[model samples]
Target: ERLHSYETKRANLQAIERLKDHLISVQLTDPSSKHRIRRAVSEIGKRLSSIRNLLRDRKLELDCAVNAAENFQDDLKKLQKFCEQTEKAIQLVESATIFVPSGTDLDYVRLHEPEADEVANRLEKQWKDVFSLGEAVIDEQFGIVSFDTILEILAV
Candidate 1:
């Protein structure tokens, strides 16, 4: 609605310009009448120019705001997906380790220790990557989810 109003005002300004042009083309015999018309045209032209500039500046500001919002949302989604993947990986490690007791079977432990170690290494790498992503989000001022909240989730 606001945009429509701006456009309407702009159209009116253009019409005013055409009228001013036609007025200027008219041959006026009185010096005072000519001077008055010229002064009015100059004032109206300055005001129209000012209005156009204001609209342009406002449009640029709106565009920048929209782009910033989109970038922030994209960053947020990326961070959220990374966190979910990391959580699933952590759950997998937990579930894998839970079934192995202290003295259940030496053979089973021996068979799975290498695999467990590999999982552990991968989990560590995942943590490092998640940390880096968190830092990047924070540095970019998009840290809507606090590190403490993330830490609490990880602790669970």
Candidate 2:
């Protein structure tokens, strides 16, 4: 909505610029008419200058706001992906199943030990990553991003 307004105003400003140029080039013979035209043109020039300055400032502000919003959204997407990957890791660890034959208990234990240790290491790494992401979010984006929204995504 704001963008649309800005575009419309910018177009109007351009049209006014063209009209001002046209006015400046107009030929007038009478002294009073020429003086009035000159005064009107001068006033229009001042007003247009002020409007241009205001619009430029507003455009810069809007651009900054848009960039901030995009960055926030990118952060949220990264957090969401991390949450999903963590959940998958947790589920995989939780659902791990081991089977051993009755007479081969010792052999099965020897074979499973390395895999179990690897799983443990991966789980530990994922936990640390999740913790780090949480801390970073709290420290950096606390005021800018919505706390409850972040929490909800984390909980998922």
Candidate 3:
């Protein structure tokens, strides 16, 4: 199950990268052919939207699994800590930028005051949606682990 989750994530990441490359190609095309570029961009955007939805659904499943695991752990404190850390990791994955930031701390600024900055707001909004999906995927996987452990103990 964990391996499945990892593969899903890797595939999504690759799709996103390809979309970025497509966008760049559209941008660099001749101005006389701008209309064609616009059409291509529109199609790419739709595909990306679909991918985002798929990622979100996977993330929700992951979240459900994580929550179930918490109930079975013997040490509540340790379980809680693990849950928190897992959530953080998921959030980090969600917030990952398609384009690496240069010298500017774009991510930090975007997180702190996205509303005031137009560029930051756009970037933040896009990443937030993606990240939310990733978080769900992580949670569901954790839940799977919890369920498997319970089954193992019961079998004995």
Best-fitting candidate, measured by TM-score?
1
Greater-TM-score candidate between 1 and 3: 1
Report the poorest 10 consecutive residues by lDDT, candidate 2.
99-108
Q: Please report how far candidate 1 places residue 136 from its true position, in Å.
A: 22
lDDT of 2 at 83: 60
- Higher-lDDT candidate among 1 and 3? 1
Model 3 residue runs over 4 Å out of place are 1-32, 74-156
Cα shift from native, residue 105, model 3 (Å): 60
List, residue by residue over 16-44, the lDDT tens digit for candidate 3.
65765576577666665665656665676
Query: Where does the lowest 10-residue lDDT sum fall in candidate 3?
Result: 112-121
State each candidate's clash count: 0, 0, 12
Task: Select the stronger candidate by lDDT from 1 and 2.
Answer: 1
The candidate that wins on lDDT is 1
